[model samples]
Target: MSIHVVLVHPEIHWNTGNAGRTCLATGATLHLIEPLGFSLDEAQVKRAGLDYWEHVDVRVWPSWEAFEAELPRLGQPYFFSTKATQLFWDAPLAPVEGTVLVFGRETGGLPAELHERYADRFVSLPILSERVRSLNLSTTVAIAVYEVLRQQR
Candidate 1:
């Protein structure tokens, strides 16, 4: 099974690193869209990946347009956001080989345009507490990836 975890305009190096680790663990490819806040060579990123960074099948794209152009060939695309009404569990998150999970920046869930463009593709993890805003980027990635894996089995 092939899974693709995409982080668009990701800001935190640590979250990226942790996401990379999760990707490596699950044999999923990691794709990052640029205008990133931190450099990929930073120590914090490597520290979070914990020596597994080198093994990660990571790809970096210059812009969203660049990545969007190749999205068709990647897999079935799913945009994750807290604003979505559809619960992730209710979505057709199966056939792991044909899934590409896209997440937005930590500060902002997803670009307003993406929500408009792929309105039906968006899915959200449930948040019971009103106090909690959203899940951490890395944590969200891990949960989504594992859900895909679970369906595969």
Candidate 2:
């Protein structure tokens, strides 16, 4: 069984790196869609991922279109967005091998076009306090990954 994590237009290297580490820990694959805000080769990214960066199963796609073309073969996709009405736990996230969890950039979340197009596929984490805007990208990824793992267990 495998979990695929897709990060679209990610702007932070540290988040990406941490996400990579999470993916590595969970035996998940990481797919990154361009254009990225920071270089993958940067020291900050390596620092965040530590020496495990090299072991992460990461695939960098040229664009969303490029990645979308391969989506069917990858797995059933569930887009993560704060704007979604459905709670993630309520979603039919299963068959770990067939599940694909897609996340957006740190600053903007997913593109508005994506939100509109995949409205039915979107799922969200609960944010209890009104004072908080959103969780960190890496934190969100970690929680989502573990939730999927928890469900499988």
- lDDT (0 to 1) per candidate: 0.90, 0.90
Give the per-residue Cα lDDT of candidate 1 at 118.
99
What shift in Å separates residue 27 of candidate 2 from its native position after superposition? 0.3
lDDT of 1 at 19: 94
Task: Estimate the TM-score of every prediction.
Answer: 0.94, 0.94
- Per-residue lDDT of candidate 1, residues 64-126 (tens digit): 999999988878889999999999999888664479999999998779999999999999999
The CA lDDT at 90 in model 2 is: 97
**Model 2 segments beyond 4 Å from truth?**
42-49
Error of 1 at 141 (Å): 0.4
lDDT of 1 at 78: 92
Report how far off residue 102 is in candidate 1 (Å): 0.4
Candidate 1 deviant stretches above 4 angstroms: 42-49
